[model samples]
Target: MNDTNIKWDKIFYGRAWIANIIDIIQTKDILQSFYFKRYLLRAMMAGFIISIITVFVLMVKTTFSLDWGPGLVNMIGAITFSFALVLILFTNSELLTSNFMYFTVGLYYKLIKPYRVLNIFMLCFIGNIIGACVLFGLMRLSDVLTPDMVTMLDQTIETKIHTYTFQNILVRAIFANFFINITLVIAMQIDDVVAKMFVMMFGVTIFAFMGYEHVVYNSCLFVAGLFYEVDHLALWPALKNIVASFIGNYIGGGLIIGLFYAYLNDHGQFKTHRNK
Candidate 1:
């Protein structure tokens, strides 16, 4: 194999770049930053709203468009998600799934001593849940779409979930996290905002096309599923999807690819916090 096509872990974390990420996350780890964290908390709510809008558009194309192709609809949905990430990342908003990726680079590299990868997931999960609830409130208050369309949306979520198994969900979760988080980190590597947006959109497009699980995105979907009054039987699928999503997300950010790379790099190359 050529030098250009090396293992991703080597390129991403081998230089101890994970420490840089730790330094950034560290600045925000304070009592004073709680106010700032609140904004991020609300941003999670905003992310749910935006992500559902993506799902809604996907629904419209699937149900109404004469030329509706699953491929096209999925692509458009991905675009929406891509833009949403750009919004969250550039605007400095808090998104649980993506941040898991960011912080894990630190933990894996030993840059962050106390924060386990699970801690990132737990914080992000709670934050994401709050955001989903905010979106539900919006759906309740506004006459956004027809009742029938709302019903369709509900079924869309329900059916998707009910079909999968625990093991299947776990595998899917791994892919979802691996692909989406990689895209997110790649987007961060870009310096320009516009370029970052394009990268993010592409990431969303790819992930959506592949039908990957993401917990935060699912949080929005869950809210919609509930709002649409999807059947209780459907809840099992959604739950399964989410549980799988959590695992997949962890694999994507913490262990499968980058984090392990970061971990190996720390061991082989640079001085960690203790040495400094």
Candidate 2:
């Protein structure tokens, strides 16, 4: 195929990821225009859903780890965890990590302003924290978090906070969101619901099994850690990890995938067609 034919093929052959990006930008634009309270509430709902999934997946992992061994347990946990994103996307929930890509693409296309991007990030993050806290409180009131479960959570928090260097945490966070946004990109292009769910699950499984850092997931975990006696969890260390992970996730999802693809598809023949 000649250059023009190749470009047309990309557009017609289900390879036009930029089309999905445009759709995301338009959706976000509508959401951003909502009243502040309503917008934040929507974000909080997303956060709550994410926290619910996190708790479910962690509990399953903790329970299974005793009998299944680490490898099998990790796989099971990762697979279970993948449902988090599936739920978020299908339910029209706002997750900060995925929004990193969406808004980045918006910025690249000049569909969103930098200030607005920052505003959305702040609102989404605060909402996520609020939701996590609410769930943590509920879990504490309930009898679900056993001593063994608390111990497992503490160990995981310890490793994230103290065992890894700053750079290590940052790098892991990058890869974690890279996988996450990549999943979102691919899932958006797919028309089949089952196929989309599988894509999301598979992409998330890689990051979860690898024990990569994700800021929102870490938020749920850190909040839960507060409920139990922690061996190595400290306020400063946790905050540091959160900060590093946030920066890394932005780099991975926003800069790497979002901006890179925006640039790739917004040029030459693709650009011409998009303009037309």
Candidate 3:
């Protein structure tokens, strides 16, 4: 680890994480050239990569379901899902869920314009959708999924989009991203790779096992379900789920965590005993 990592490892306890989060938010605001088109392209590429990886992991989860018990099965799925975010973070890629925190923090700090942040979000969202559609199409054409796997995916589709009411979907999504982004922020505050991975896995596993909705991951899964002609997985219903998840994720990550933390940290309300 470097000096910054060493310093953080020594002092990253309690509310000290707030200082670290603020420093990271400020660093992203200062270093990222968000106004440039190249940066937009980079964001798109990052979202694209994340979508592809997400689909692969979901496929693994659905395909191997018969071999493991329900709890272990979900655990395996969550672990693989957590790996996708880990790769995104370590590679410096943009994920919309995580970016929600960044954009919110930047806006609160007056370091980024609202319009610019929205543009970043739109670009990344579109990119992720496009990537997901491509992967689904490819998987369908290649006959990659077995009939049993397709059935399993269809059941998941029913569970995610069809069974839940709009309100139910929105609420679950809120809690899902709430825990996810919290994990993200905590992991970002830490320096050790092992600790970071462990925390991320635990947080992601909690949400995944709870069957919470996430916009990007669901985009791919629903599209793949649609492509496979899964029952009740229509375009309109899937779209509704996606939109509700997006809103809930924004609330959970952007407002709940980002705005809340920024407010407390800015007003010097984060000085717990550990910091002193």
Candidate 4:
């Protein structure tokens, strides 16, 4: 084959991408045990690790005095935050936002039952929150932050708590996970580690820099804020944000990307492929 054809074979697009998603759903079915309970702990662990990284990133950004102009700070921060998803993907964790796509694909193909998928999603969601809360408690106890870092953390929390409305959170959540699901779905079609990393970073950057909502990441930050005694971040508002964002993420990942891709590929026909 010519060099162009050879290059093309190294990539997955079109029918191959769709077929890979089908394969992914099948693999998810086989891994039901992990999904049901084990993945929850794994996801929690992943959240803890990611939250630490997030703290570092926020702290570092605070240390920098460079006047990089509008959007530059967030750009740097977003790229740093992108590592969270990379860690999740590499570690085989069950983050809720990402799983929206996976569970949807499984359900669409009838490879897994609805109740089972819900069980896994709910477990993963709660697990992520618990993991983040643990980290928050530890961080508070350790007194690990410098005064500036604490200020930064407080400011971060303040913004999240004070700046957003219910509508703002919902809209941003939709697009945020739209980009995220693109990353997860497209990454599924590839086999190369480097390629996967690049895809994930790009997807995460888009989501973060755009100021979109991601439920797990938000949970980490929000809970961490609670440790700081951010008054605006009352339990009720935080819970509301989580619920709205969760629904938005489900729509973006599960409906917009996952179901759309399945429908496009095979009109989302169940009868023919249900047995597979």
Residue-pair clashes per prediction, in order, are 4, 0, 0, 0
lDDT of candidate 4 over 54-129, digit per residue (tens): 7877765776636675467778888988888888778776688877886786677777789878877877778888
Instruction: State the displacement of the C-alpha of residue 249, model 2, in Å, after optimal TM-score superposition.
Output: 0.7
| Candidate RMSDs in order | 4.4, 2.7, 6.5, 4.9
Where model 2 places Cα greater than 4 Å from the true spot, the runs are 1-16, 268-276
**How does candidate 2 fare on TM-score?**
0.91
Candidate 1 total steric clashes? 4
- TM-score ranking from best candidate downward: 2, 4, 1, 3
Determine the C-alpha RMSD for candidate 4 after optimal superposition of all C-alphas.
4.9
| Candidate 4 error regions (>4 Å) | 1-37, 65-70, 267-272
Which pairs clash in model 2? Answer: none
lDDT of 4 at 206: 91
Tell me the deviation in Å of residue 107 in model 4.
Answer: 1.7
Candidate 1 lDDT score relative to the true structure: 0.64
Off by over 4 Å in 3: 1-41, 44-59, 62-64, 268-276
- Residue-level lDDT of model 2, residues 1-276, one tens digit each, is 466556543563233566666777677767767767666776777778877787787789888877888999888988988888888888777789999998887787677678988988988899888888888888888988777777778889989998988999999999999999888878877899999999999999999999999999998888888766567779999998999999999999999998887776654534443443
Alpha-carbon lDDT, every model = 0.64, 0.82, 0.72, 0.76
| lDDT-better candidate, 1 vs 4 | 4
* Predicted structure with the largest TM-score when compared to the true one: 2
Give per-residue CA lDDT, model 1, range 54-155, as digits (tens). Answer: 556645555644576767766665665566666666666667676666666666555555544445446656766777777667777777756666665666
